[model samples]
Target: LKFVCFNNDGIDEHMVWLIGLKNIFARQLPNMPKEYIVRLVMDRTHKSVMIVRHNHVVGGITYRPYLSQKFGEIAFCAITADEQVKGYGTRLMNHLKQHARDVDGLTHFLTYADNNAVGYFIKQGFTKEIYLDKDRWQGYIKDYDGGILMECKMDPKLPYTD
Candidate 1:
């Protein structure tokens, strides 16, 4: 597997891969509307990193940095259903974390993790927190279910960075 930044060359294949994973995505992210998820992936404003196998996107992550706030928010991440449990997710996340740290100088990382993903985030050294930042999340907080905010400090000692 190879990791690549999202670019015009691979966006179409990535979109197709995401569509194929829609069912799994719905199960993992029940609170997020499908349209919103697609929008996040297609939006050029956000940065994305993709894992490709045989020239097809099999896993990836999307994130946005709030540099002034010293934090980066992970918008979405997933591995193709067939690709799960092979450590690809961990590899992708580590890449994202390093990108955030080295490129953005972000000291913290935050993400709204689905219930099924909470444990994974915890294992990555994130701590759970009730996300009540209405100003930033707005109605999303109310719409979200079984999802909670998880955060990690970008310390070298953390498992996520190692």
Candidate 2:
């Protein structure tokens, strides 16, 4: 699998890749509201890293930095259902960790892990955290009951690798 940093200038290409993976979120993350997903896709504040196989987009991750560039949140990440459990997610996440560290100079990464994805995030070095900044979420996160807030502190000495 190959990964590409999304080019902001290529809106059409970004939409094509995003549309291709729309079903994965719709089906896998049913609890997540559709409006939120659409907003994430339409918003330019976020940056994305896409996974490609044979020149076709297979998966991707979208994220954005907080007011403080040292911190950021992963808005969405998904691989085709057929491709799950094959270490693709790990590779994507590792790429994200590296990008966050090298390009953004970020020290921490945060995200809301759905029920089914909690364990996966844990395995990827994220730990549960109490991030109570409702303003930061734009009221998108009401209660932490449905999902878990996870954070990964990047260690400069350790390399993120699959």
**Residue-by-residue lDDT tens digits, candidate 2, 79-144:** 887888998898998888888888878777778788789998999889886443545454443345
- Stretches off by above 4 angstroms in model 2 are 67-69, 129-145
Q: Which candidate's lDDT is highest?
A: 2
Each prediction's TM-score versus the true structure: 0.74, 0.81
Instruction: Give each model's clash number.
Output: 0, 0
| lDDT digits (tens) for residues 81-153 of candidate 1 | 7778888888888887777777777777778788788888887778886343435444332244566878777
Looking at model 1, which ten-residue stretch has the lowest summed lDDT? Answer: 134-143
**Candidate 1 residue runs with Cα over 4 Å from true position:** 6-31, 129-143, 156-162
The residue pairs in collision within model 2 are: none
Give the root-mean-square deviation of each candidate in angstroms: 4.3, 3.3
| Candidate 1 residue-pair clash tally | 0
Which candidate leads the pack in TM-score?
A: 2
